[model samples]
Target: MGARLDGTVAVVTGASSGIGEATARALAGEGAHVALLARRRERLEALAGELGDGSSVHEVDVADAEAVARAIADVVARHGRLDVLVNNAGYGSMTPATGSALSEWRTMVDVNVNGVLGTTHAALDHLRRAATGERGIADVVTVSSVAGRKVSGPAVNVYAATKHAVGAFSEALRQELGTDHVRVGLVEPGLVRSELTEGQGAAQQAEAEQELGLMEPSDIADAIVYMVTRPRRTAVNEILVRPTEQAR
Candidate 1:
């Protein structure tokens, strides 16, 4: 049988690893041509090879507005059309507000907040156009975090702020684009065993592995695919997914 997204095209940022990489693979499995975007050329190329045909890679830093715009344009040029954009490029520096340098906070804002804006701005025209195409729909899925839903700890100050920013933006975009048949959704994951989680201390990692069991990157990827595959009549606005043992 044919796949659900046959003949469609999808662009996934941060496709070099973690949730982004998993999302790209999942989209490709559904028969959408997947474009992997990340700063690491080697990793993207390697992933592209793993995904085989109907897959490509673009080296890009989401925080760079011009670079992101050009990358999206190139994807459209290569694929003929764009149907889905997964904004999964983000950073988290879990440092206390008092000790963390100003640059750290700013960097989080650049990648987590401004990056989303730049990609979304550049892809709006194409996404809207896709909605009117034969598929009659388009998708913009943002990989947010549990931090986006609520402020957790002092170390999550800037990261939480950036997540919150994206959450608000996704909601407003969903409101404005409903009539256009453009589905905007946010997947908020609590803890996933990725590079981001690996950055935490040994104690935290042990706790997660032993007590709560960190979620796999594919977990978040599945949530993203579900949001975009819904029938046109139903729009999944937001999904908050936490590990089974996570209380907050």
Candidate 2:
């Protein structure tokens, strides 16, 4: 039998590392032609080499709306259609509001909030087209965080707010696109060993790692692959994965 995502074209933002990197690999394993998108050219090229053919790389800053639109167009133009878009590019600054640099807050909003918007908006029409075609469905999976569901801590103020914004956006898209056969979903992860978490102080990072036994990026990638590969009639809307030991 053919693979689950056979003949599909998938675009994954932030594909240079972590969840996005793992997700791109997982989707490709399912026979999807994965388009790797990230600002890091060298890293994207290296990963593209590892992925071999049926993989393409696009150097993009998701915060740039025009660039995202062009990238989506390029993907569809190169491939026949676009079946999946993993909106995974994000920035995190878990600093208290009082101590948070205004620049950090703004940058978080740009990459975390605006980035999702730009990519999703740019791909909506293409996804809808694919859904109505032979694939019978298309997927938009945004990498959110446990903070999206609830404020994880005091310092995650703006970070939490940005996550919350995406969560609400996904819900609205799900409602608006269900009839179109375009699935919109969110994956909320907690305390994974990622660039985002590594930003925490060294001692605190070690403590969190020791206490929670943090999840691997591949775990979240597995959830995403599962979400998009479900039967056409089944829509896995939201997945919140946390370390087994992580508590509120």
Candidate 3:
């Protein structure tokens, strides 16, 4: 069994599906009381029901700053404390820059970059407080992508840019919060089979699948579980996880 998170209260954004859904399940299984945040009220409610009494559902759009702040505040109020913040809400449309619609790029930046900032900013104080409490530490884990590490191709231009932006933000926050006993970490996943990658017939996608094989969302969730379960004195800074066959 994974290390217990019996008293921890976790907020998982984008919890309706994909990595967010998997992470929420993993955290709850480890004994955390999780707040599931997403725009899909029905999905969130269903997930909460599945998680039983230890979970709460909140309808939220990470792209809306004020709404996100309100949701985080609500979680803190209901739970009395926040122990883990997972910034997993994001969108990506891999269109070549030359032919891509400006709106698509804007969507990517709005959710992947600005959304992370708003959520982090709103949760920072609560996270700091959690760190000083009985847990003795708190965690902020952002689900970035391998695109954050390297620009794969022209098609991933805007998406890669947004991931890179959040990566930089996470690193800076890590440096600043290390002293506060708040661990800021990033999980860079490569080609996990999620809705984001569905329907994209990119050559890169095929190449990735053939080489490294696609990953299950649970694989990434396992990495997150590892990060948060460590002893109070240990801070897992970042994780770069990919399927064994993946070259990049």
Colliding pairs, model 1: none
Write out the backbone clash pairs for model 2.
Answer: none
Quote each prediction's TM-score.
Answer: 0.98, 0.98, 0.95
Model 1 accuracy (lDDT, Cα):
0.93
Let me know the TM-score candidate 3 reaches against the reference structure. 0.95
Model 1: per-residue Cα lDDT over 1-248, one tens digit each: 89889999999999999999999999999999999999999999999999897898899999999999999999999988999999999899898888779998899999999999999999999999999998899999999999998897889998999999999999999999989999999999998989888888888898888988889999999999999888889989888998899888
Off by over 4 Å in 3: 1-3, 201-211
User: What's the lDDT for all of these models?
Assistant: 0.93, 0.94, 0.92
lDDT of 3 at 140: 97
Error of 3 at 133 (Å): 0.8
* Candidate 2 lDDT over residue span 6-97, tens digit each: 99999999999999999999999999999999999999999999888999989999999999899999999999799999999999877778
Put down candidate 3 lDDT per residue, 1-248, tens digits, no spaces. 54489989999999999999999999999999999999999999999999999899889899999999999999899989999999999999988888789999998999999999999999999999999998799999999999999997888899999999999999999999999999988999998998876667677667767777999999999999889888889988889998887777
